[model samples]
Target: MQLTHFNASAKAGVSRASSRRTTVRVQAAAARPSWFPGNKLPEHLDGTLVGDFGFDPLGLGVDKDKLRWYQQAELVHARFAMLGAAGILVPDLFHQIGAGGPAAQIPWYDHAKFEYYAPINALFGVQVLLFAWAELRRLQDIRNPGSVNQDPIFSQYRCVCACV
Candidate 1:
C-alpha cells in the first residue's frame, strides 16, 4: 500500500512547502560562506582575482571599475617604491665597495649639498620637464584607456622616440 498525495489540496500544499524550502536553501547557499556566517560575501568577488580570499570586511571594492583602478594604483606605487629602494641601495653599495669617485664620497643624505654645474642643472630641468610630461600622458591614459596611442613602434612619425 503506497502512500501517495492523490488529493489536489494535499499535493498543492506539499509542493509549495518543498519549493519554499528549496528556494531558502538556494539563497542561503549562494549568499553566505561557511566560514563567515555573519557577513555575506558579495557576488562579484568569486575568488578569481589575484589575491582574492573573499575577506571583504569593510565592503570595499564593491564597484568593479574602482577596484581595477585601485589595483593599478597599487601596482604603480609598489613599482615606484621598488625604484626608490634601488636608488638608495645602489649608490650606497657603490660607496661601500669604493667604486664610484667624488660623488660616492658624499653620503646619500648629504648629496643635496653637492653643487651642480649650469649644464647639469639645465639637463636636470629638462629631465624633470620630460618626466612631468610623460607622467601627465600616463595619467591621461589611465583615466581614459587607449586614449593615448602608446604604440612605441608605430606612434606619431614612426620614429620610436616614445620608447626611449
Candidate 2:
C-alpha cells in the first residue's frame, strides 16, 4: 500500500483509540499492543501516520525511543539531504528556470546546467535509497544471521565506473 494511505490508516487507528479514552486502563491497552513496545521502529513505524512536523514517518512527535539509533541517524541524514538538495535546486535551478530570465538562455545540455544537474540528482537519489536499503539490510542481518548480502547498488556503481 502507499505510504500516505498507510499513514492515514495508522492515524485513524490512533485517533479511534485516543477517542475511547476514559478513566480506565482500557485506553492504554487499546493504544499500545503487547508487541508494539519492543519491536524495531520499522516493525511498528513502517505504517505510522505522521503530521506536519517534517515527514513524520512514525508519528512520533518528540518521543525519540520509537526509533533505533541507526534509524534515527538515517532520518537525520535524509532530512539534511532533502534540505540541501532542495536548497540548491529550488533557487539555483528551478527558480531560475521557472522565471524564464537570463538563466533560461543557457543551453540545457551545458556543462554545469540541467544536463549534469539532472543526472547528478538522479544518481544522488538512487544512492540515498541504496544507503537506506543497506541500513534495512543491516537490521535484517541482526534479526537473522547471514541475511544481508553485498549491496547491488554499489556493485552497479562499480560496473558503471569501470565501463566509463
TM-score to true structure, per model: 0.52, 0.22
User: How many residue pairs collide in each prediction?
Assistant: 0, 0
Clashing residue pairs in candidate 2 are none
**Colliding pairs, model 1:** none
lDDT of 1 by residue, 37-119 (tens): 66566777886677665676666788888887777778888998999988778888888999777777788888777775656
Q: What lDDT tens digits, residue by residue, belong to model 2 across residues 32-105?
A: 33334554444334335432123445455355454454465667689889997775555557545576455554
lDDT of each: 0.69, 0.51
- In model 2, where is the ten-residue run with the lowest total lDDT? 1-10
Distance from true position, residue 107, model 1, in Å? 3.0
- Give candidate 2's whole-model lDDT: 0.51
